[model samples]
Target: MSEIVRKESFKHVSYLWDDDEAAKLAGDEVALLIYRSNLLGADLRLTNYGGGNTSCKAYAKDPLTGKEVEVMWVKGSGGDLGTLKKSGLAALYVERLRNLKNVYRGIEHEDEMVELFNHSIYDLASKAPSIDTPLHGFLPFKHIDHLHPDAAIAIAAAKDGKKITKELFNGTIGWVEWQRPGFDLGLKLKQCLDENPGIRGIMLGSHGLFTWGDTAYESYINTLEVIETCATYIEEHYGKTRPVFGGNKIESLPWEKRKEQAAALAPILRGFCSSERHMVGHFTDDERVLEFINSNDLERLAPMGTSCPDHFLRTKISPLVLDLAPDEDLSDTSNIKARLVPAFEAYRALYTTYYETCKHPNSPAIRDKNPVIILYPGVGLFSFSKDKQTARVAAEFYINAINVMKGAEAISEYTSLPRQEAFNIEYWLLEEAKLQRMPKPKALSGKIALITGSAGGIGKAIAVKFAEEGAVVIVNDNDEARLAKANEEFGKQFGKDVYITAKLDVTKDEDIQAAFDAGNIAFGGIDIVVNCAGLSISKPIEEHTDKDWDLLYDVLVKGQFKVTQAAVAIMRKQAIGGDVLNIVSKNALVSGPNNAGYGSAKAAQLHLSRLNAAELGADKIRVNVVNPDAVISDSKIWEGAWAEGRAKAYGITVEELPAFYAKRTLLNEIILPEDIANACFVFVGGLLNKSTGNVLNVDGGVAMAFVR
Candidate 1:
């Protein structure tokens, strides 16, 4: 006879709830619901960022009839429970929502079901309901909470999950097998409750847990109780002899060293993943990551499946593993690329085979056949996506999955939904429609941009514009105070993570190299480089000293070359071409008196841009120049002595000098910093993807500088 397992009690488990705190939450049910949802989301062990949802059944007065009616306030579609607000919940009439099932014919598709669910809303002002509304509606409870808690999923995904669940809950909790969430799953939940009338909750096998009560506190406490019980069971059974890799700790590389190593290999991985679409890479090496990557069974267990079924949408069914030896030197770029290229090809071939073998007749066309997560033996894990944020999100899910797998394997073997079932969730019509409904991203959504002299004036304006269009920005300037102010301003408008500030003097090759390396580490690689750093020196040829001539050339010409050289090396390795925009003056094309030092340097820089365009065109790198005559807004170049000299030459006061230059153009309009920013956007945003070796005049109408 088999030994009987004792049911574990959760008397020692701690919770975040306090009766005093609960009573002080605005004295309303919706506020309580939001609080409960946030409390659950705060603990990643309880729920992921946007994975779980909570709902409460309450009474609200109908605005039309002035009568109280039963309503369910559920988390709205696409709302993150971590930052949930009152506006994030949709209120629907209980009877109206229940009646949705009657209208659903047996032949209705997922899209048709979503439409019916939306029509069940009691108020037109409420947001759209979540896809799982019927699951909450059919259950006979006043308060319901559903979450994909890691501990609960660890139990639910075991090979003998039914046996383990009965032992832990003493048969007081009902169990339902895995089913795609829809009207059918709702009916199954109702059936489970009917069969086990005394059960407090139902555990959906390989999915999640559902608990309910008459009050929000009751439901939340019940959820914690069940989660605690599962955790205790895993502890008692698997906590003692948990498997470890070789039973010895591996001396892991430091984070800074890992980043340095990643800098050399990330571009090669990005190059392999790039096709018609570009891919950005992000690296992670937390404690949990180290445990998983250093495990003895990593190659066998990691590729089985995700911790939960919904994760398939973001992380795919499995991750691709690479053989990065511990003793190998990662700083060698050539050796790293030679190893990574073949691995990438093999992973793609495997994915193609999986897609052909598992896709259903109704499945949507296959997405890009590249892996989102890659595991390196010694270094760490790298996640790829269209942008940095999404890449980080994928990494978070993978980390959570690693933890859950460890817990499940401690008791029994881990199991996941089969390939066909995973494919059903991945290609669901309603989920696909959500992607379609999202507003189109800006033209440069996933690209990285580096701008020099971005503390003020045209450089600052261009930095703001690129951020608005969805590019991650690297703001560089020699002035520390001005750069700090720019950082604060950009952080307020966009997010703090949208841009990084660095002190750079473009004249030094070392400074140029360090700036590019910082950007490559912060983001994956550099995609756009704009050289707008310059100073003005207006004097006659004979009056100008050699010092003045060298200073002008060092900034305008030599500095531009150093920055471009560093950018091209990174771009060439990425093999995904980039854009280079140099902010020149109209003086480059049309010379003026007493402008010998400035004009000669500007002209040399202009020709250098043309030269880069000629040499880098075969690699798909585009180089261009934007020449503006006068832009006095926040202009440091036109201040003090330089302004007085230019004004005296124009036979006007300093204040009228701008107007004097404006009147010379055919349009007679003064150029602003935004005008030059717009022209840079045009070339860098791929509007002229095929055009290179070009100069655009932003001087309102400079006929002499205009290209035929």
Candidate 2:
């Protein structure tokens, strides 16, 4: 008989709270309670600047009358949860906030929203109630605590997230798909409660978990218990591995030396910070950081993925792994600037492509196409904030997230929330409002994407795919009439705001950058890049020429490298994660006749894709290759002369080519642009978040099937 394997239960954490002190609060205690809330904000991991929010509901008597008045002391807008003051927690009529939820769905006017906002009894000094007032009011519980717990999210990001959730919650939980968190979320929760009357808490998909209790401590305990349990489960099942990003330990360094390093790198901060108040700097251990610098695989893996979307608010996607000689001195900043500029340009190009592909005409323009913060090998992270506090808060969030991602990746693949889903949440008004209430320490809005070779076929398909998700796409091709017609057809279904046309050569760097710059200037920054620009020439090696090889390399490999390099630079400056997808042929891996030059060029492109992925990983720049075959189109292989020659060589009629290719695959069907487009979006978006330096084959199972 097989031995019975027993699964383990989750461990819970006890929050240290002074119960007697908390329960003894009277009118005089309001000041102290508010003060305590502010103290918690200093721990940026929990509440980065104005991330996690807190509130207290109480009944107080009117000054002039004996009648009881019910009010909620909630954190105010623009107040960091860590450094909040007694006055920072606004006193608003609880009845009014509850009332707003009833009317929120029906009201569509901005004026009414502004009017309702003004009615609250906000502290004369602080900002409005934290954006979570609606969520708080809608909850039946008196006190509520919400946080984007990194541990919980790390568990939630696994391949078996659903199974884990079932294990953790058992049957007494409610799961809600990610929705704009506001009045809509409130209404949805109410419906969920109506269905599952006995549920203890809810988990927001692609977001985080929610728990509450009658008292503050109970609520806090509930939140911690959920996180602790998830963390323990993850540690046990996944088997905990030490963080790949290294530990928080810092070696002793002289204050003067640290200051000197900070002084040398301050200019990079100046461009993105846009102000001095938000500037903060730190230096890392010389030996440990260089360990990553020394290893090629480590350099490639570091920036391969993000811990969470929240990281964008700080370190963006990745950091720069500086070039250092084995015996060279550690304090050199000479090579830093040279690397920084080109990295920023590459980031911009990617950012532009992402923005163009994702946004429609109605979407807002881009903003801050440069990274607001950065981390360098042998140096700690640096960020520009509206104020010093902001910089620290942003850095803290990213640092923890980066650590979590590295740790998570060690156990299994580091996955990301799907790109379309991330876009939906990012653009959702309710979520943005919550961010706005906190001064939005990190800026990620208004980015564009420009997809080239997009006039019908895979290029056009990818362009439309990005548009539906959230990006303003600039479609380009050599065929003007075809380009115009494809745009019109796509526009009729998606809308006119979906596409812009550019008749230009993909081989020219200036042409690509100019198109990218125009798009970025129109928006603010570019966020994603998909290189579907390619062509195939099928002639025996003897018939191929130096000119043919050069043209093939220029289109398939060199063009993509140039475009990707430029895009990475912009994204680095913007401090945002950018994606690059190269459309290479499956023939590179498994070859066919008279296609040596084409296959060889594609192989070179595929290698460049990985090299780029390795070099740019630290900048939050990801590069991957897509290998597709049997994509029926007007390529040289399917045309008149080539088809006739191929038919004669194979001793089969030209009409049999489609069936021959299709039957060669496990699934007998001609691959379409739409199929390739689906894979393209999945990679660019967050579906393959933890994937880079990966070669994904969307060739209809051809990799597994053998040809007769």
Candidate 3:
């Protein structure tokens, strides 16, 4: 799609409608509705993830009546506008929906309206209608947008919102007092249009904005014009009194220092938040968040909470604002932890009280008491959720709230939704039902794994297996090219936000720390570590030099030690018992000629795993080993000399090595990298979870190398 750039004097927001994209879906009202929504939703300034609803009314052939009738299409419950699809839209008979008001008893009976909405659906198989459906269906216009754009919401959240609305648009835009969205609110909008008779749009109090036109394009333009006007007004007022939020109270740390603090703090925060269920973390040091956190009014504004219901729902009623005084040292980890522990406990207590205060007879059971978002004065915001995307989106939503607060405080006093009102929406019976319908989480749903040498071979197999079980993985490798390839393949398989990449050498302490830091910044911290990075050099003892021995020990033994040592520090800080699975070898136990260096290194790795198991048992950190005899398939260790050396040691050609190794096993099976990965998973996958210091021989029944 292309745009004929508008000559309007508007700044602050763009007019992104592309004629070519619209033309492709010309005459398809639903597609155009989706197009308009994508453009509005593409920018966070316009709306947030799954925040608002958009709709269009058009004539459609009623299958039952075989006659054309007006039908309304709206974003389905829990659908994000940016990714709205035909399947994500609910289609309903407009007249039937409007007629639902006839059966509506009152606001108390609004929860029952959904069953009536189900009956009004034009197609029974259409996506379920959201609670916001009435706000669209009851409207008189052919097209409408209910957006929580920051500019629009800034005005809506202001203390004098109604008066400001009246003066800003000069009667073109009307205002409706704050009311929970339902049939009653929809009817109030209808009443406003009736009473005024000529208002172009309406501003929803403590909520969002409504703009409509006969066509989708026209509606899109009206929305843009309304938002730009609000932006212009806010900026004009903001200029006179810049440095809003009552001016800055604390100075922002240097850019790198802020991120360093965030990285160091994320795992601890994630562990505290994961008390009930393991939670993934997302960190953002974006300047906007910094501006707000460093502001003097942060203490006053943060607890009042966000005004918009969308922002309130994802971010919770309030954030856990860490008490980091301006004079406090950001690098003092112990002092930070001391304050955080008590602060977290207090937040939980507050939430319990809030739930008790707002409970109705039929309210849903109290949910997890952890706050979704956390803020610190010198550092940035960290959001926690079951997976990375939700965590990231929750962080994004709070930033949207920050923007809303910025504009509101710049112009007028900002206010929050009534406590009871926010609670009703959060714990509403309908919202509970939505939560109930969610699919069951995977076994390792919130566990994060960091797999060394995951760019290929057995390491990659372990990574894929872990990710498949709902664990987010940090795929680690020293090879840049291989890491990129692994990243691309993993991304294709698992989509974004579930996995991250770390390029590092396990042999170097700096590299190991950087890897863990990357994991902390990306996913809080890892709960599983697979020490799978290794290579082989099979040679006669007489021919083996000091270089060969050092090289072998450095990669196979020392590398695993360094990575696990770093992982233990993180696991200890998180206080989350974790899994450390070492990929050893049958060579460690079985005697063979021309294998002195490689075999001794494997023995060191095996002993280290056992020692780690004994030493770390009190911390509940499990260390186990998997010994696979021959995992030559697609392995970098078996490319040239290693393969030839192993083949020669067995008195066979490279092509015959597989068959020979298989025949040597009692079960006569050729072991693969995946078999080794399966053994690794068994140690950590809750099957053999209680048994640490264990050895699993995945050599297809090679009795000579059996653990016993």
Candidate 4:
């Protein structure tokens, strides 16, 4: 029987090259290639951050021989093409690289291939070349660009991928079946080029696309042409029928309402997905993600596999789809927990079976078998990862995958690489070794920390401390300007993407809920919560007004309660146990004269920590109190009327008051905000992993206030 052909009219591919700007960069070829790479990298539709590679070959004077020789300048490992600089491309002598293929007397292992590639580098100062260096090196073209564009992958991952490629590009493109990337795949690519000398591009079935030309513009424009052609094919054949969920579905809450719902659901999902170690949860209700989650065929379609094999590295083979009842109340903690527990258990069992069946005997052991993407019916999608940035990256890729899958299913049935092929990519020794070479994470790495009133003083110190230790910090404060400043400073110190900021009023329930949601969305979930938001009010018992009492209690006691409640709900749901540190005043234990309202509310806050410890110990949640006495350095709390009052009461000026307080301590040391932060870290950093309901004093040894 003759095969049915699917024809699609070609669409114009957009180019982003700017000749005026390109004129400013160093070398003509290098500048043009960098410009082209940034153009491709800037568009997530073309290629996302660090997801694709580009290269150009030029003749350069060989230092030792003083003869013109070919050198390949390819995108280096660990560099993003979007913001690529000339230095981002690794330079290697093309002849030296090609000669290594002759040196290859069939190696028994893949690691040896990587070693051989490393030794071929011509410049010692250049960054390490990407693993696909050989593929670009062997191809007989002046310029080459390889990208896993969603449009191309949609066509490449179909059941009749080869037929589709032949029909679309006809005589101009060659198609290769899926093969694990290494020396073998590189050799096969060279063979394909040699056999199809007239072809301009090659489509790797169940992989991605590669296009090349004699010039940078030719190669870049050709890549866009291929992708645009595939996109047109999907559009023409698919008929633009939007995916629809068939059943009588529960009405989804609005975006803002769903965020609140996510905050409630995150903890439960985190707990269910967690092992002995905690896993953070990030929630997204993106329009595309919502469409996928709401699809009637979601249960069948979502679990098939990733849109491309590269995605398996981030999202794993498949996402875990939850069978959430339409009528179930997501606000009810008990109901959500009950539903997630069984769903998680089933997912674990299925994951174990998949791993056992597909993984090679030599495959490295799985890190954490939990699914990275979690599709919660009414709540949207929750992505899990060791840290916030990784979780966000996974979400970005999965969102793209969802769109690709939908597009493929619309045109033809969406298909992916076989189970074992995905397993090979996931456990590939070359990829695994890259991760092994990374530096060890800090003590609190991958943990998410939320600090209230983090704009200055002790709160700010704690935020910096946690961030320095590799925790994804959620900086919360009512002061917008200071919060932005803090966010910028943290970003400057640790890449801006490391921490997120939330403008929050701890006393407000909506603010508390929103902050938690932001943290959950930024990272995966909250692991540590520190309640350090406070204000000082000193007055005699009879002189204290109701307003003064209310403000003091609202911030110190009630505010702490609400934030803790939100955090505890998430922690309990994540089931990975967490730590809660309350920054209480030493007045909580020893009341000073004329400080009735402040001391009383602080005392209440201290006792509340004990109550939470007792209640949440079974859940493995630890609660402790940090009682800091008269912290004077870098403290905004001691700058106003409260400072003058305390100083006057101590029979000294503000400058002398610090010394007075220091002498009161048996150790005679002035307590700094950092000192308080250190004590706070001891509890939240798991130094007291076995202990809770404890009070750690940072008063430089205030004998009376110290708790034994």
lDDT of 1 by residue, 1-708 (tens): 111211133343336565667889745787889888887777777777778788988888988899999988988887777789888888888888788777677534545776777666876777788777878889878888888877788888888888888887899888999988877688789999999997888898888899988888888778888888888777676546655422323555777776666666667677776764776667777777877777776877777878486566778888888777644576666777888778778878877777788777876777888888887755688888887777777888888787677767877878878887787777776777788888897788878899899889999999989988888888989889988889889889987557888888998887787787777766778889999988888766687899989999999999999899888888887889999999999999886888898998999999999999999999999999999878988877887877887776667899898889899999999999999999999998867999888999999898888765
Error of 1 at 640 (Å): 4.3
Model 2: weakest 10-residue lDDT segment is: 1-10
lDDT of 2 at 614: 92
Among these predictions, the greatest TM-score belongs to: 3
The alpha-carbon deviation from the true structure for residue 433 of candidate 3, after best TM-score superposition, in angstroms, is 1.0
Model 3, which residues run further than 4 Å from truth?
Answer: 7-10, 239-242, 325-335
State TM-scores per candidate.
0.91, 0.49, 0.97, 0.91
- Worst ten in a row by lDDT for model 3: 1-10
How well is each residue in 50-74 modelled by candidate 4, as lDDT tens digits? 7878999988888889999888899
Tens-digit lDDT string for candidate 3 (1-708): 235456244477767777777889988998899899888888778888888889999999999879999999999898888888888999999998999888999987877888788878987778999988998887888889999999999999999888888999988998998888887888899989888878889999889999999999889888888999999888888737656777888888887777677777888898899999989999998888988999888989999998888887888999999886533564565667787889999999999999999999988999999999999886789999998888999999899899889888888889899999999989988888999999898877888999899999999999998888888999989999999999999999998887888887887888888889989998998799999999889888888999998888998899999999989888877887899999999988888989999998999999999999999998889999999888878799989999899899878899998888899899999988888877777787777768899888899887778766
**In candidate 1, where is summed lDDT lowest over 10 consecutive residues?**
1-10
Better of 2 and 4 by lDDT: 4
Scored by lDDT, the top model is 3
- Which model is ahead, 3 or 4, in terms of lDDT? 3
Candidate 2 residue-wise lDDT at 14: 31
